[model samples]
Target: MGLKSWFSKLFAKRVVQKMYDDAAMAVQHQEQILSYLVDKGVKTEFGRDHHFHAIKSHTDFTQKIPVRDYEGLRNYFDRVVKGETSVLWPGQPVYLSKTSGTTSGAKYIPITKESIPEHISAARNALLSYINNTGNAAFVDGKMIFLQGSPVLDNSKAIPTGRLSGIVAHHVPGYLQKNRMPSFEVNCIEDWETKVDAIVEETLKEDMRLISGIPAWVQMYFEKLIEKTGKKTVAEIFPNFSLLVYGGVNFEPYAARFRELIGKEMPTVELFPASEGFFAFQDRQDDTGLLLNTNAGMYYEFVPQEELDKPHPKTLSLSEVELNVNYALVISSNAGLWRYNIGDLVKFTSLSPFKIRVTGRIKHYTSAFGEHVIAEEVEGALSETLKKDVAAVTEFTLAPQITPESGLPYHEWFIEFNREPKDWNVFIENLDTALQNKNPYYRDLIEGKVLSPLKITLVEKDGFQEFMKKRGKLGGQNKIPRLANDRKIADELKAWSVKTIASSNF
Candidate 1:
C-alpha cells in the first residue's frame, strides 16, 4: 500500500479499536458514569435540590428529577449563558447552542466543557467504524466536504450562540481540518446561498472523498456542483467520493435522488446528534439502527411516546427498554441537562449493542382529526410508493386543510418531483393507501367522511427551496417539517407556488 493509504488504515484501525473498547465498557460501567455525573454536579442548585449526592439509583434519579423540556430548564440555562459558574454543570458552558422552539420562539442549550469531546469523538468513531466495516480507508487520503451550518456565532451573549454544527466546527482537530473542504472563513459566512457558492468554487477541483451534511442541503450542494461544472453526476466532479455521512433528517425521502446525483451507490453513515448531545450513530455496516453512546458521559431514559403528554409518564432506564417500542428520549448529559426531554421519538431495533432508529419528533407530527400521522409513517409511505412507481421526489411536506368551507377536511401534500410518475393519479392512490394501511386512525378517517382522500399538489420547480430560502432556513441543519397539525405551512406553500402544477382532489 502507498504511505498515505497505510497511514489512513492505521488511523482507522486505532479509531475503531477505541470505539469498540468504549462501547463494550459503556453499559457495563453505566452506573459509575451516573454516579460520577451526580457527584460532579452535586454542588449546583439543581443537583442539590434533586438530591444528586444522595441519589442511589436510576429510580431515585427519575423520581427526583421530573421530566423537563427546554422551557422547564430555560431559567437555569439562561443563568449559565450569563456567565454563572456551576449553575448547571461544574462550570459555565463552553458554548450555547441555539435550536428551534415550539411556542417559545428559540431555545438555548448549554454545551459544557466535558461534553465537547463526546461530540467530537462520537463523530470521529462513527466515520472510523464505517471505514473499518467497509475497509475503505482510502477516503481518508482525500478531502471531505462537510456542508454544515454556518460556523459563525451570535456573540451578543456572554457565551456565543449558534447551531450545533457551528459549535462542533470550532472544535475540529487540526489534522482533519487540513482534509476538510470549505475554509473556516467560508464556513463562517452566515448566508446559506453565498456560503454554498463559495464551497462549490473551492472544492470543485479538490479530490473529495466523502460528503457529510443533512441530505436536503447536501443534495442542493451536489445539484449546484453539477450545474457549475457541467458534470452529469457528483462522482464526476469528485471522482474519488465514496462515502456520505449525514444526519439531522431522515434520508428515505431523498435517498433515490441522492443516489441518482452520485450516479453510483455510496456507503452512508447515519448519526443521531442533537443540540442536547450526540446520542447514537450507525456503528456497523450491516446494521440499519444506530448504536447508543452508552459511555459518553450521558445518561439515558425512555418514556413511551404516547405517554409523553401525560403529567407523570413512566420512564424506563436502559435495561428496562424493549425492542420496537416507540419512546420519547430523555437524557441527562454532561451538558448539564437533567432528565431533559429532547422531543425526539425513537424505537430500539436491537438490544445487545443497543441500536435504535429515530421514529419522529414530538412536535413534528400531524394529529389533526386524530389521524396521528408521524414522520416515519409518511416517509415510509412515500419511499415505498415512489420505489414501486419508479419515480423520484425532490422535496415534500404535508399539513392538514381542516377549515375548508364546503368539502370534507383533508391532509394536503406539497411536493417537487425529480422524475414524475407515469400515472400521477395511481401514485397518489398508492400513497394514500399505504398511509391508511400504516395508520389505522387514518384509515378510520378515510373510511368515514371525516377526511377526504389525500390531496397531492405538485408544486412548481424549486418550490420547496424557495420556501426554505424565504424562511431563512436553507442550510444543512434546517429541515422542512414533514407533517403539521395546522395549515400555516400549506397556506404559505400555496401562496409561494401561486398555482399547483397538478392536484389530486378525491
Candidate 2:
C-alpha cells in the first residue's frame, strides 16, 4: 500500500471506531443536551431574560422561549454586534457567519467558542460516517478540494465576519491541510471567476480523490478543468477521483450534468449544513434521508409546515415528531441561538436514527395565487421531466408573471440546459403535469383557469451565471432564487434570455 493510503486507513479506523454508542438512546441524549445548554447559558443576559434557569425539560424550554425567525432574534444579535460579552452565549463570539442575503437580508450569525467544535466535529463525522458505511477510506489517500468562498474576514465589524464555508476552511486540521488541494491563498480570492481559474491552475495535476462543494460551482470548476486540459471527463484529469460531497442546494436537477462531467457514476454524499449549524448527513449510501445529529451539540424542533406561515407557529420536540409530515426546522444551539427558526424546511423519514430530508426553504417558494409550491416540488418536477426526456438541466428559476391586462397570471420558468430535450413541447408539458400531480393547489389553479399554463423561457448557456454575476452573487454559497413571489426575476431573466418559448396566454 502507498504511504498516504496507509496513514489514511489508520486514521479512518480510529474515526469509525469511535462511534456514538448512545445513538440508540436518542431521547435521553436530547434531554441531557438541552439541560446542559440551559445550565451553561443560564447566566447570560438572554438566558436570564427568558428564565433559562427554570427550563428543566424540553416542554419547559419550549414554553419558556417563544419561537422566532431572524427578525425576532435581531435584537439579541444587535447586542452581540456591539461586542457585548455574555449577551447571548457565555462569552463574546469568536466568529460571525455572514450569510448570503437570499431570504431576508444579510445576517451575521454568531459562532461562539462552544459552537466552534460542534461545527468542526459535525463536518468531520459526516466524512467519517461515509467512510465507515461505504468502506471508502481510500478517498482520503490523495487530496480533497472544497470549492468555498473567500475566507478573508472583515474585522471592521464588531466581530470578524465572512462566509460560513470560508470560516470552516480556516479550521481544517493541520494534517488534512497538507492533503487538501488548492492553497488557502487561492481560496480567498473575492472574485468567483478569478477564484475558479486559480483553483483550476493550482490543483489540475493533483491526485484528487474527493470533491466537495455546492454542485453548481463544482460543475463550473469541472468545466474549466476540462477546457484547460482538453479532457472530456474529470476522471481523465484525476484518475483516482472517487467521492463527491455536496450540499446547499438540491442535486437532482444537476445530477445528470455533473455525472457527464465526471465521465461515470461515482458515490456522492449529501450533507445538510448551513450558517445555523451542520444538522444532518447521508450515513447509509442508499438511504434517501440524512441522519440527524441526534447526539450532537444542538437541540432540534419541528413545526408543521402549515403553522410556519402563521405569526406564532406550534412546534414539536424531536420525541413528538412523526414521519412523512413536512416541518419547518427550529433549533437551539451552543451558539446561543435559542428557538431560532433557521428558515429551512425538513421532513422526518425515520425516528430510530433521526433521519430527514430537506423539504425546502421557509421563504423560498411561490404562493402568490394560493398555489403553494415549494423549492422541493419545483426541483422534483424538473428532475423527473428531464429524466423522462433524457435531458440535463444545468440551472433554473421560477418567477410569477402577473400581467392581468394582457394575459392571465402564471409561473414562468427560466431554464439553462446542459442537454436540450429532443422534444421541446413534450418537456414543457411533462413539467407542467409533474407539478400539477405533486401539488393539489397548483393543479386546481390550472384546472380552474385561475392561472395560465406554465410557460418556459429557454435561457442561453451561462444565462444564470451571468445574472448572478450582475448581482455580485456568483459564488459557491449563493444560488439563484428558485421561486419569486413577483415579476422581478422574471423580467430580469426576460432581458437576459437569448430566446423566449412563450406558451399560449389564458
Best lDDT among the predictions, by candidate number:
1
RMSD of each: 1.8, 1.9
lDDT of 1 by residue, 165-207 (tens): 9889998988788898789888888888888999999998899
- Ten contiguous residues with the weakest lDDT in model 1: 496-505
**How do the predictions measure up, each by TM-score?**
0.96, 0.96
lDDT of 2 by residue, 255-361 (tens): 89988999999899999988888888887788968878877668888999989768767898888999989898988888888999888889889988788999788
Candidate 1 clashing pairs, residues 3+ apart or interchain: none
Stretches > 4 Å off in candidate 1: 498-506
Overlapping backbone residue pairs in candidate 2 total 0
- Alpha-carbon lDDT of model 1: 0.85
The alpha-carbon lDDT assigned to residue 230 of candidate 1 equals 91
TM-score of 2: 0.96
